[model samples]
Target chain A: MKFTYQINGAEHTLTLEKHPEGYRAHLGTAIYDVKLLHAKDGQLHFQLDETRHTAHLAHETPAKRWLHNAGRTLVIEKAATHRRGADTAGGSGRLTAPMPGQVRAVLVAVGNEVTAGQPLLLMEAMKMEIRIAAPHAGCITALHATEGGSVNKDDLLIEVEEIPT
Target chain B: MPQFDRVLIANRGEIAVRLIRACRELGLSPVAVYSEPDADALHVRLADGAVCLGPAAARESYLDMNKVIDAARQTGAQAIHPGYGFLSENAEFARRIINAGLVFIGPPPEAIEAMGDKAAARTRMQSSGVPVVPGAQDLADDTKIQQAAATIGYPLLIKAAAGGGGKGMRIVHSAADLLEGAAAARREALHAFGDDRLILEKYLTDARHIEIQILADQHGQTLHLFERECSVQRRHQKVIEEAPSPLVDESLRAKMGAAAVAAAKTVGYTNAGTVEFIVDPVTRDFYFLEMNTRLQVEHPITEAISGLDLVHWQFRIAAGEALPFQQADLTPRGHAIECRLYAEDPANGFLPATGTLLKFSTPPGPGIRVDSGVESGSVISPHYDPLLAKIIVHAADRTAALQRMQTTLQDTLALGLTTNLDFLQAILAHPVFVAGEATTHFIDQHLPNWQPAPDIPAAAIIAAALAELHSPSATTHTTASPSQDPHSPWLRLTGFRMGGGE
Candidate 1:
């Protein structure tokens, strides 16, 4: 079986085949004899080639794996099946919450015209106040976030229609 | 003199744990108060008794004077200890504790109020013969502000009168930006601290932030425990702190120490406090900044160098104990450095990151100390400060201390969340930091746009792949589960191993 993973915006491939003695693994252009020594409780002890390695499985999900090895932590994510469209190429015209936080204030109202780089909202997260700015000059078509309301990551907070220009 | 058999700690996280340890060592039972979300916190688990104050919002729980006092009353605690943040420096809280017939393990309420106001504190420091930064206050209108700006000249700083931690501060380098800067600063000050008053000061370029630790007793005996260099800062928040600054010689240390002692004595301060100063590196001239009426977060580095337990002394002083040693008997022995481990992304403008700590480990060795609040499986909530732990190392000299700090940070691992560990390592390796020439602008002047190394090692990739193949959620075609496949290599595995490859 073969698998593809992304780390730090770069992708790598790995293949594994069962063998009578252990397993044969192919990573990038290198092949190595791999044997699992132990695996339990989010800990994996394996021998790759002639070196023994132990990696702690910090977190695991269907699309991501967080591993800790050699005093460094790395996050490996499965390549998304469908790439996101270039919504941010020019401007998305739709603003979403970048992280979970509370809306401290709403500086703009519906139907109000805003210029690119102008602050439209204020948010409080992690004990710091963050200013949410307009991605492009546009007319506010909808406002979904209310003052003092909590929001989740990627939740749409505002929708704007670009002024014809 | 007041004697207490039980003490209630009105704080959470690492500092609370530190105080609890102190209370236990002093033969007093320690009680803990926590919010709803912090019921399972390490501090609560380690305390002799625990109470639920209120909800998770600090305003309703940790910062609520009524709730905290009630918790202490219900727990039968005779004294209350407020750690660094929260209500530690609130004068009203201390007053209420005293009115409730409970001892407040900190300075008197009068001292807290005296130094809590930055503008008022500056005036007092000047009257007490302590050198203060050239600035003007009590500007009630635009005309007064303009005049003050003219007197202070260009490149002045507009600061919030009721602020600390660098909030509501703006640096204006030209006269044209004075009014606008003051207005913006007022708005920020009102938003952050509920006060819109502003002050102007001459902005010093290339200054070092050195603070003296002062311990005072009720018997009018005060002593200074040397200095801690906290010049490495970002957005005015301290990142790394060290003891016995490399730039300070015997003569300079004596001057600063005496100034700090005088500042504390003027405020009638008792217990452990810090007097922060802004020193010009070229002339070695220092100006009084402010006096913190409570224990500071970086007290561990002072303890490392002075070989004195500050928390223990705080308890003793609050109990009306007298000093056991004279000023001539105390002297710093070695160098110490501390690196704060925060749950924030240095690559992304230092935005705080929140997640569960799936794997948490601290390095263990000689001359190393880890003061942490979280463990494996702990959740990192966004409701409070992002500080996770502090890694401090002590050695014979500055060079050896820096080397030990680098090794210690490399050995510490905190996964499932973004951290400043890599950024701290980069700072330790920087030539400017190595030469001990770093000023308060080190992060901005030297490493303004630091990013983590982009290359991922082959070993990490292999480990990730193998872990995924063995995960229970993996597809049956790729998974080699011992339950489903008896001939799988996982079934042949026997003993467990730890750590990385040699």
Candidate 2:
């Protein structure tokens, strides 16, 4: 599968695949052999090695460096995440979850005018505290998800109508 | 042997991400293994492939070696790199890897076995003129221990022979403290190292913990890669590490290097390893402690100073290649220091805390190198080592290195999750630390409520409030009346950098 992330307002495509060693990512790929066990609050976990990292990763997500692409705003992700010199679209933008979280605070009413990189709302996944920033100048034309709702991979929270001129 | 085009990292967090980079450098495809909790992990998204291993508890996932090896086979992986503190040091697991015909990128099982038992290694080193500390010959037999104590003198250390990291060890200042200390050491040794056999050693006060890096190829060219001063520690666990120890003059370095070489040679070692020693600061005398028969957590510091690729060399040596560099060619350059980033509260006695990472940041500048295993949206649990990342700084001199460290820490931020940030900051500012006079007991001597000084006062609390106010994810957004609810919904924002994610 592929994901498009914006860096400083430039959209970069990322290709993510399922792990061969039994990993299944909803947005990426499905891996066989690895199993997922359910936990408290319907949380699923997986252990990778014959040690504790898997568990640590499950409970402690942000501490894992591998998940951090450590690059520009638009990280391609994956081994191919090293794409440089890619063209930046003039009118492209994105609004991603600021923190790995669910949408908890959607203060914007649709069709509201907003500047580039303006604050949209709050994403509340993983106890992650991020003020989702607008990717480009636009009007809040559509509300994709509702406040006080749970969302997953690629769940659209809100849509912006690109403002011409 | 079938070559696997891609090898999946069967873990999450910073180590997993670090391994993925290493695999990329090694020309192998990396598969990221993650739990449902880590769906957003950087390693998983970055690897060529990803797999869900199991649930969050260690027993079901990372410790599930079968699933891991099977994942490798399923991914058509030819080898697996077990990063430290996980399956990286498990000898039985290594045997299993060999039994299954998958390359385990670590030392041979026999070598691991030899050194795993601290007592056994002590015996081997003693015979090889490795100058081990004087201690009891075996687990304390009441009578034998009494005699050994009388012979070895007072102020002895009862340690688990097969232990590493300060687990299963105790200091006995007198005969009155002997039996209890012995029991504590024995029990801890049994649990941590799975070996109950222990020995007593003469405890030297104010000893600078130092170790020499060594690399051995299959053809027997074992080279010493100088020494690292790991004197800064807390509870016997190393906290800060630097190469070409400040206290080690040329003569001391030469002597210690020779001893480390002898120790590795005697063991017929064939991989990147570390031989630890206790150097008495007052007299400048040193004694052999133990040998770690694998790459160390502090290897990057050694690499920073020596300009060597220990991991890449491990892979090369495993591939049956002659060491590319000769012993005479190896030399260290500028000084380097490493501080471990852990998820614990020093104010709360370093108690480990688990939560989703709210913010993560790291400093990026010249002479700063960082190795981490976690990212944003990642959760911290109590299932593994509390360490989250390692921040290393290199500079032309010790003073510059110290300054560099302070700068790096100031720029780094770990928000949401509790961490030892304050502890590390306190350690950096310690009087003894400033003067370059540190020992393993450094943390014990100077920590009660270790905290990092914010560039401004009330920075943490105010930032939390501002972040909550501006946060797009704040569910309650009750920064105003945090006292209203029991949860005390305080919003946490880490600095905008790569090193601050806790």
Candidate 3:
């Protein structure tokens, strides 16, 4: 059987074949003998060639995998056709939440004039407060985040249409 | 003084768990207060009794003084331990706790008031014959600020009078930036700390953040438990802390230790507190930075080296006990280092990450201590501090301790969210850190463009592929088969997959 995996934005194909002792897998161009040492409770303890590795799968979300070995973690996910980027990338002049957090305060309102680098809102996450600033001098056209509202990463918070001097 | 048979911990997270363990060790009952979101928290589960304060917001729960006091009263707890943040440094909270006939396991309210304000603490330190950074008292007006700036010269700092953790702090390189810097500092201070007052100090560019851990009792006995160098920081928040700074010699340690004791004595400080200092690496001269009037997040290293239980001492002191050991009797035996594991994404400017901790495994061994309130299935809420745990390792020397820390960090696994664990490993392996040449500007000087781990092992990739194939949705697909036929040439694999969802 041939399997495809996406890791850190790169994809590779693994071809698995049955063996008398164990299983042989050809990952990309390299071939290795794979041994399943232990597997239970979302944990995978396996051996590839001479090296051993442990991978944990989330109980609820099985498509995501946390692979641990050699003092490093590789988070792999099933490749999706569409990728999510910062929502403000299309020259919309909109500010988006940099990470998941709660809006501590919405300092600016719709139609409020703001200067470049002026703080427009305060967001709190992980017990730290981050100030959201205007990317450029503009008037606020829309505000999507309210005080105490929870926001996710890449969620649009405010739209600022730059004013031509 | 009353006997503290049961202590109410008016805090949450790792520190609360730490206090609960200490209370249990000392044969005292621990009463934990939790917010609505933390009803199933590890600390609540570990405590002898638990009380629901309010919602997830700190203002409505942990910081709510009345509710905390009422919980203590209802639980019949004789003492209250305000761990680290939250209401730890609030003087009014101490006053209320003491007035309500409960022992506050911290410094006196007078001491808290004097040291709580950074500007006032500097004044007190200077008056007590401690060397402070060249600066002026609180600058109330523009003229006063300008005058102070002239004396202090350019390359000065505008700091919030009642601030810590880098909040309301600004640097001015020239006269042109002084007013704006001071204004912004005042505004931020007002918003973050509720005090708009500002202070000016001659900023030292190349300095090391060295702090002394001091324990005082009611009988005027104060002693230093040695020093911890916490120069490795980002945005003025410490991430890596260790005991016995590489720069401090016996003479310098004695000098700084005496100064820390004097500062504590001047403020009538009691219980466990830290006196922070900024030491110039070249001149070896030290100046008083400020005094933290409560348990610090990095206190574990001090405990690891000195073999002392700081929380136990706080409880003993608050219960009207004297210092058990004199200054000369205590000495650090080994070296210890602590890495703060935070739920943050190093690839994304260290932004906080929130989620249900789908997988959390702690490395266990001798000389390794993990103080954590989080576990498998724990929730990493944005409503509180991102600190998930403190991974502390003690060894015979710095070299061994560093090696142990690297290994322990590798074994420490946390999934389902972004974390600073790998970033911490990178720091531990950095050449500068290995050479013990790190200063206050260490992180900025090195690893400024810290990216996430670059390479993925082939084994990991293969395992991820297998897990994906074994997933429920993938099993239902047309091509992939979930189960294996042993008699045939196919071998089946069973493992759980991590689903990246909210």
The TM-score, computed over Cα atoms with residue i paired to residue i, of candidate 2 is: 0.70
What DockQ, on C-alphas, does every prediction get?
Answer: 0.12, 0.02, 0.12
lDDT of 3 by residue, B1-502 (tens): 3487999999989999999999999999999999999999999999999999999888999999999999999999989999999999999999998899888999999999998788888888887899999999777799999999999987999989988778999999999988988889989999998899999999999899999999999898999999999999987889999998888888999999999999999988899999999999999999999999999999999999899999989998988899878999988878999999999987778899998776788778999999999997798899999999999999999999999999999988787788999999999999999988898898889988898755667777666555543333211111222223354221111122111111
**What CAPRI grade goes to candidate 3?**
incorrect
lDDT by residue (tens digit), candidate 1, B191-293: 9989988889989989999999999999999999999999999878899999999888999999999999999999999999999999999999999988988
Kept native contacts, as fractions per model, are: 0.27, 0.00, 0.28
Q: Given candidate 1, what's the lDDT at residue A93?
A: 74
Q: Against the true structure, whose lDDT is highest?
A: 1
Q: How big is the positional error of residue B269 in model 3, measured in Å on the Cα after superposition? A: 1.0
Q: What pairs collide in candidate 3?
A: A57-B498, A58-B497, A58-B498, A61-B499, A62-B497, A64-B498
Candidate 2, which segments miss by more than 4 Å at Cα?
Answer: A1-165, B1-11, B187-195, B449-502
Mind giving the per-residue lDDT tens digits that candidate 2 earns over B1-502?
1244465565667777777887789887888766666667677888987777788776677778897888888878777777666676678888998899877777788888888777788888888888888776675577877788889987888877777667877878999888887778778878886777878899887778999998888897888899999988766677888876879988888889999989888767887888999998888778888888777888999889888778777777776778877877876889899999888776676788787654567879999988987765566777777888899999998889989988787667564466776567678778888888888777776664554332221111111122212223211111111122345232322123111222
CA-based DockQ, model 3 = 0.12
* lDDT (Cα, tens digit) per residue for candidate 1, span A96-118: 88889977656554435678987
Ranking by lDDT: 1, 3, 2
Worst 10 residues of 3 chain B by lDDT: B493-502
TM-score on alpha carbons, each prediction: 0.80, 0.70, 0.82
